[model samples]
Target: MSTETVIPKVEKKHLENPTGGSKMEKVPGKPFMEIHDEINDEGQGNFPLILDDSVETQTQEDVKPKRMRKLTSGGQEMYEKEVEKYTAELIHYRKNLYILINSYYSGELETLEVRLMPDRINKELSKYQQISEKFIGFLKRYRTAESAREEATQKIIFKSIVSKAKTILNEIEIKLKQAQLAKSFATGRKFKPPSASSMLIKQRAKMDAAKTNLRFASKEAEPERLQFKLEEEELKTKAELLKKKVEAKLQMELLKSEKEVAIAETEFNAVREELEMEGSRSSGKSMASVVDPRQHIERYLQKQQEIMKSVYINPQQMQPPELNVHAAPFEPKSEDIRQTNYEINNVSVANELSKFLLKKESIDVSFYEI
Candidate 1:
């Protein structure tokens, strides 16, 4: 006991022993290490080392950020609600805009209305374009990470809406050119009434030759002043008849142009509504791709014509004189003609032409736009 001090061979962990006392046990699963040194005899020594198993390497999947997922049911419903709201209002505004435009084209609107029509049409088209852009943006935000099928569907809807909008503008251009062409044809064919002086040239010559007969008893005894008055009255009567004919002819052309424009408008609305309906189809099945809008429009129009043949006026079948222009609210009546004449007389032709040129330039610009 006085001189014995034993050294321990290894460090150890404590474990429960049988006699309720602690005992020393070597740690389990410890890595075995080996080292050899032959410094005098060996050329080199090698030792392999390893890190703890706790460190791990990550896979590619875990290293990058994830894409967004499809929207939830509630989010989809919300999207649908917003889209319908915008499209419905856009259609309503567009209809009103077309109505105003039709009025302007047919010369039924007041001078103020004519002046304001383009601004209002632009405002509505601007609104429509904005709504469509918003719809596209919203669709992208919610479905950016969508599967291929949904992505394709969204793209089709996007293209259809964009195409329909551009087509509407084109339709407007076509109608304007059509109306202008008709106006030119009418103007060229209109009758020119003779002036009072020109109408009385023969009478004046006869009167000069009959100076000798004035002294003799003759049927040519009417005075020069009364003869002049008679000729003037005859000329006035003929001029009124010619002017009335011109007015009626113009009214007829206006009617024809308006009918065609109304048909075009109907076609446009049909295409738009078809696109909207296709866009709103349920997601369970694959969405239908956009059909040809012209086909849809034609079928719709044809069906309407067949079903309501009595009320329907065939622009092709009827002559302009029989067009019943007064029945159409947008078409001009006599009062409307008078109003337009007043506007034209008061407003310079050059000013009106300049306005038209500005509008045409804008339309040309829009054609080049996406």
Candidate 2:
């Protein structure tokens, strides 16, 4: 083995492998420090390099002045007119808001819209007030300063105020639009007509109901007929009731008559029994004995009168006429004799006859005429 000097030839290759290459060699042209400084300058290391162009474009756009339309005299006059109109409108709105707020505070104007109106109105009024102050300041400046530059500046300020007023008015318009949308959502359905199908259904239902009612009316016949039928039924019921009452009354009268007849029969039977008893008692007595004792006395008085007349006529014959005391021709039975004796004992008829004969004999014949 000869001891020769061996040197290893190392071939330098371009960095294609990331792990093997230096970190600075990974970037194509820029150094790592320069990239780091650029990232630091951008204030964000995490920002993507793709946004650099957009950022630069945005910056350039920001640096350029925005184009504004310059108003001519006519446009200026129109703008002023518009401003004045808007100011008047804003004043009108403010006054309305103030009235509404006062009403709300005084417990009037109570509604959902009125309640929410104050906040929106106040916001707009505040904006308008700011603009108005600015306008007044501008006017004051324009009045006091006589320089052209000052006048131009004042004009610019007035324009700004008008623009501000317009922006505030636009905000108010947006709020009004929102309110209108809300109102539409709330009250829109009330104004909408019913759907055709619903209306048709209701009409059909009504027609059906009407038909049902008509059918019922036809079934029941005319109202007059129904009324007559009801009246007839009522009359029949009343007549039946009256008939029952009449029958009851007749029956009651019949019962009363029967009771009266029974009472009369009972009284007649009592009277007949009394009369029969009296007849039986009287049937045992003779008719002469049954004659009143007053008749016997009258006969005795007649005989005395006859004797006195006979004595008065024949005074030469002083003898009195004989009295026919036994004028009854029937032979006196023992019962009749006993009855006559009882009558004579009870009434003293014999004594009365004797006394009358004695009185006749005692009377002076010279003082009596036949």
Task: Give the best candidate by TM-score.
Answer: 1
Clashes of each: 0, 0
lDDT value, candidate 1, whole model? 0.50
Q: lDDT for every model?
A: 0.50, 0.47
Residue range 144-214, candidate 2, lDDT tens digits:
22222233433433343344334434544575678789988889767877899999999999999999999
Candidate 2 stretches greater than 4 Å from native: 1-231, 279-370
Q: What is candidate 2's TM-score against the reference?
A: 0.24
Error of 2 at 152 (Å): 31
Clash total of candidate 2: 0
